[model samples]
Target: GTQSLHTNGMDEALALPTEKAVEIALRTQQIIANESGVADTVDPLGGSYYIESLTDAIEQQASEYLAKIDKLGGALHAVEQGFIQREIQDAAYKTQRAIERNEQIVVGVNQYQTDESIKPELLRVDEQVRIDQMAALQNLRAERDNDMVQAILGRIEQAAHIPNAPLMPLFVEAVEAYATLGEICDTLRGVFGEYVPESWV
Candidate 1:
């Protein structure tokens, strides 16, 4: 769930600088693929003293945290109690303060400032593209088997009422039936309801 949320947010951010964003992402992935050395052999960094020590320390720290979480009844319990969010917020504040104080040297932000004269061309999402996507949705509905799609969707709605029913299969069927993403999400919203966050103090 967190990964999906992360991907969605990052996708929007990447779209802000579409071309350069994609290029940077691709290059980072390429460097990790080439230099990670996981494929060459088993236990690649097996004997490195610093790495081994660091691994042990991390494992111990994680185990301690997990034990504390379990004592309080696990990750869900920690979140419900606001401990996880508070801890994260504290860490983030510390990091932000450090960066502001120049204790953290973030290369582009702090260390290497540049004022170039030439302006770069930016990507823009055309209003026509949105209209075209809407038209595609309408075309799909016009061509697909409406009766079969309705039956499938009715079954999906019924399945949501039953406990422990994995919705993945139903989702795949919907996708295969050329169901619009918005339609599927609307059905889910009907079942689970929308999230309405409380105003922060």
Candidate 2:
């Protein structure tokens, strides 16, 4: 199930996959199998000089990247310092710029421009669905034993504060007690403060 989306710089709200796009995508797979005969070969470009060189270069670069991250005190430290986030942002920006400059041709996006409006059937979630969910949660909380729920939540909070604590069992117990996601999160939030991202701009 491949759906083509018109995402303007990772914004998912603008995703509109048309029926024609879906048909084209399906036809592409058929063409690859029938016309291109891609399925007939095992590692079709395996021995090609260009493919081999590109593969080696990619592997070497990845290894170097991992080594640099290890020097910076591993993945957690890199994430905390926003190094990983910045790298991803930079890569996305470069790709977008390349597409805009026509250096990268993304078929329907950068090349083969279409003037016709493609209004696909969009999925819409009903407001009543959320209201019903909230009502169900309220009912569940009201019916469950508050004292037991609080005791389990308190244990969960205590476990979270301890370094390398086995919190999985406690989480399982909390869920079995019919504790809502918000309740579990809120309990943990009290112990561990919510994450606030550092200014990257």
Candidate 3:
């Protein structure tokens, strides 16, 4: 039985879908659920041998990947060492290669493509909005207690270095004192440094 449904609007890849596109997507889902009669059945492919085999293969592959991560001292260490990043990049490269080679088919993309140029009209943010945001942020900085913000930010930096320190309260305090997100992140970044991934090329 289906518990949920996700129907993407056409041209969702480029930007936020238009209202007409979203309505069309919803209508398509309604048609499939009400008219197709598939929703009347539960566990339609529960006893299928092909589906069972596919499920087993997925489980086995996932277990193997988990074991690999465990060997590398779990997820954090794996990410720090760039194992996860490299795996993602490699997988993406393989998928792109397959699509280019026609081993994988994406309708309207690599096969049975339309000749007409599809130009989507994307909504643009006005320059005045940015100017207003900048002014508001500057006003906030001037109005808020900068001294308190600095003191809390200092505590946050110190807490980050200490093992197992509860920093959430300090974060809340910092935010209440009008500390900016970038300032807090920058302070933490100064302590932990940054992760620079190897060049994919």
* Candidate 2: regions farther than 4 A off: 1-51
Tens digits of per-residue lDDT, candidate 1, 1-201, equal 011211222244435666665676777666655787654665677799998899899999999989999998989888777777777878899999998899998976777867766455556889999999889878989999888787778778888888999999999998888877787888888887886533332
CA deviation > 4 Å runs, candidate 1: 1-17, 28-44, 115-121, 197-201
Worst 10 residues of 1 by lDDT: 1-10
Which of 1 and 2 is the better model by lDDT? 2
Clashes found in each candidate (C-alpha, N, C closer than 3 A): 0, 0, 0
| RMSD each, Å | 4.9, 5.1, 3.2
TM-score of each: 0.74, 0.76, 0.79
Which pairs, if any, clash in model 2?
none
Higher lDDT: candidate 2 or 3? 3
**5: Cα error in model 3, Å:** 6.0
Report residue 160 deviation for candidate 1 (angstroms): 1.2
Q: Which candidate is the best by lDDT?
A: 3
Please state the error at residue 191 of candidate 2 in Å: 1.7
Distance from true position, residue 201, model 1, in Å? Answer: 6.5
